[model samples]
Target: MPASLTIQLVNQSTSENVYAYITGLAIQHGMARVFLKADGTSLYFPGPPPAGKILQPLTENCAIPLGPPGNTVTATIPQMAGGRIWFSVDDKLTFLRNPGGPGGGAALVEPSVLNPSDPNADVDFAFCEFTLNNDQLFANISYVDFVPRLPIALTLQTHGGAVQHVSGMPPDGLDKPQTVLRINTQSAHGTLKGTVPAASPNQLVIGGEAFARPTTADILGCNSGPFATGGGGGASAVRNAIIPRLAAAFQRGCVAAADVSEHPSHPETFYRAGGPANHYARIVHECNLDGKGYAFAYDDVQPDGGEDQSGKVNAGDPRVLVVAVGGGGAPVRITSTFTFGNTSMIKLAEVA
Candidate 1:
């Protein structure tokens, strides 16, 4: 049986947010081509903004060229069978495959053609072109494998620097962790400086049981849930172990987070003001450490709200606090402090 493939526009800021596009038939084996009409269409997918909106294609046929500066655009493509496939945008190129079922997969390509390239290539596996915008542009191809059931891995190459691996684990050796892999440029040439230049990294070996040495998940497990009950810190623990390995390998900051909750509107339950159950809050602050700085707290309670039955002095409802501090040396420290009811959890460790 041939593989089933479907391609739809995943992101576009110019159209109504709807999945009214096309649900192409299952892709069977060989190469199945799907075209996107850039003449005004929007594609939707699961998740939040930037990561969700799968943009429509600019052309109804194969091959599209995005003139000068490559801008932001998103599109979604579904794969049925498990195998290797390649993708290219403008002059940038990469490959993807489905190793365990369907979902996100790893990227395989060199660093040179990861982004929009100057001198574009004609014969690409999949082609797309769009204008460059102030917003960050992204494109991805996923592989699905049913045999051993594993998470999809994405391998990305940024400019002429180094290949940085970013994806949830089950791909890299860890078991089901969300982590962000950051790669800063060590050296560059011409206009590639500062920006994540176009290049494709190599293929990622997933689910081989070989313990590929330094492995990390994008988001840790602990603080990822909603209720303030059992196992809220497991994710952070895994992140602490992986950060040092990646930082030493790439020589830059590789930040990762897990179960850490966002701020809350209501202090008592830490729920969003008018948001849904999963709504998150944000708080930013700067701390001046005196070399012997031990501990500090940020007041979360509001003044207007009166005290409860405890009479312990009412301030405001306190929930979760994500702290980010810079300026130390060697192993930098970024911690998350969560206060639920009378209980508190503090995580002070290296970047994941």
Candidate 2:
């Protein structure tokens, strides 16, 4: 009779061995094991091992010592892969077989080409490449296993996480609209894994887990939704592209027209206008590209002694009031007083 077991990795990868015979070496506690690699290589404890350890191997074709024959014990030769009996060596067996762990301790194998001694590669074991230690293979560096998968047949299948379909001629001047997408899990492990397909503006990837850190741009996108924040009064850019008028409306001034007290050098303001006072001012109709209805600060008259005790006359801020926007019902007003650099200019010129 023979015994067998399977080794599965933490990342959900698997490999199986139907026959594994106990090493005849006198290992302490009967813990030493010898199994054959997928490539027909062998791993086993060499020499007079510590006494007590016993592990059974499955072999349908090999002869075993049914009864203890003399002091020189003989272990069974498991099913062969490369026409050679397999054996285990040190440095290649660092894993502890916890028969108590989930999956019945059969879920894992130690010192495996799939699992490197250094845990640093735990994140990439599923897709990295490593070569197996054959009978002729000598030491140095660990191995990363990568099994190959078969070609997937193309067909019509709808899936979630759908990327937006892009359309247009790419810089390469090629217009390619990708309609058919093949989604599948990585069949093998190693340097080769997921693919992005040919480079095309419309080439869209479908599935598989791609390990990547998320960026702020990916998480907090522009306010494209209804619950997004409104934009105005910033050194940056306008938040909304749909309502330029609405954004400008929230902007100070440009409400109604008022007395100009007009001077060529001084910027014009609707004395009763609502925006902050500044040295410069301009009115943008936005709707007109002709630069129509544009106005700016040309000159100004600072108050006598700069400050008036009346506070009502703070050397600036002309009492001459006027309408900012005319003919559109209630006008929006703004102060026409010109300060040295307090210009809160608004842009209606962007209105199209």
Worst 10 residues of 2 by lDDT: 148-157
**Collision count for each candidate, in order:** 66, 53
In TM-score terms, candidate 2 sits at 0.16
N/CA/C clash count, model 2: 53
Q: Show model 1 residue runs off by greater than 4 Å.
A: 1-4, 15-269, 273-296, 308-352
Candidate 1 structure quality by residue, lDDT tens digits, 1-352:
1122232233221223222122121233122222222322322221112333332122223222332332333444333222222233323322121222122321212222234451222322221222111232233333221111122234445456766554422422222232322222222311111111125122121111111222122212112221012336532333332222222221111112233121111233322233212111211111322221211111222112423211122347855444445665324343676878898876667653
lDDT of 1 at 184: 22
Instruction: Give the alpha carbon lDDT tens digit for every residue of 35-111 in model 2.
Output: 33332224433222124332322222222122221122223233222122211211112222323222122212332
Alpha-carbon shift of residue 274 in model 1 (angstroms): 9.5
Residue 193 of model 1: what lDDT? 10
